[model samples]
Target: MTRLNSAATAETQQSWASVLRITEVAAGLPSSEARRPATPAVVTLQMVLEKLQAGWRWVERKRSQQISAKRLRVAETISLGEKRTLSIVTVDGSQYLIGSSAGGVQLLTKLDDATPNNSRDERSQ
Candidate 1:
């Protein structure tokens, strides 16, 4: 097997990461102005984790909690074969199993009242 240069490998990885970000942002653009193919909004692990952690931080900030005792922790990680995996995470007293795969990332289940209530605000089609 031919050996790949370390610098070349890192450069290629960086280029792909940049391309992925560009594609993500382009896809986020309005349909009329978008140059990429139409598809469902891509939700990466980073996005989901960020949203989850942000919500917690917001609540903590609102309550004027100075000490950073409460923190999101990954309790366990289980591979469900293939590229799919289940992560059990906890923050305060709440726990959730987040499923991540090539298809998408979703909350398998959560022991908390963190779900948003938007149905009452939604307008009928």
Candidate 2:
């Protein structure tokens, strides 16, 4: 009877050890339902520079800065009163009539923009 009891006790210890092993493995593994999807790696400026060193030309990725080409030019001016005057100014080929008085400056009207193409078209006509 003592030998039978000892055999049963050994089997119970083995079963408990197997249960502890299963618990440890389950704890170490990440849950499938809770796991997040991996995202793609982002391209950095350093990566771009490395590619450029390898003779890769970056065209559109680097934007070309636009320098201001428009300049204000007074075309014609006429006095309206003692302190008031109307001046026609051209900016980037567009003409505008501006009024200046003792109070302040005000935009009077917009005239037809005079471009080289328009002048050429007029001369051809």
Candidate 3:
């Protein structure tokens, strides 16, 4: 009788372990096969250097694009008097004479592509 009881207990424990394993699978836990160690990633110095160079090239390209996109620039500025000044600004391909005082800035005139003397004459008039 004791022998039979021990056999039954062994069978019950085996069935319980199997049921727990099935429950774990249903709950999306990693199985023994999926828990195996993954292959190590191999990185070389050449790989690292290549990645760094590509990153620098991208940064340089972006910097050059930003510089090229600048269409407005102050060509020259002159002080007219106290709190007053005159400036020549270039936008795209056109130049403009700007006046700045304590109150605000004003666009005096657009300078032409003619000689500097002619531009000055036009501004004076």
Select the stronger candidate by lDDT from 2 and 3. 3
Model 1 / residue 44 / CA error / Å: 54
Write one digit per residue (lDDT tens) for candidate 1, span 6-117: 7786686576566556655644668776555534444474465456455645755866664556588888899999899999888786888899999999998885545335
| Cα displacement (Å) at residue 107, model 3 | 0.4
For each candidate in turn, the TM-score is 0.33, 0.35, 0.56
Q: Which pairs of residues collide in candidate 3?
A: none
Candidate 2 on 29-85: residue-level lDDT in tens? 577732754333322533443454333223322322222443788988999788999
Query: Model 2 misses residue 109 by how many Å?
Result: 1.2
Compared with the true structure, the alpha-carbon lDDT of candidate 3 equals 0.76
Give the poorly placed runs of model 1, Cα more than 4 Å off: 1-70, 112-125
Please list the Cα RMSD from the true structure of every candidate, rounded to 1 decimal place: 22.3, 31.1, 27.8
lDDT leader: 3
- Residue-wise lDDT of candidate 3 within 35-115, one digit each (tens)? 755434322433444565556567669978999999999999999898999999999989999999999999999987896
Superposed Cα deviation of residue 29, candidate 1 (Å): 69
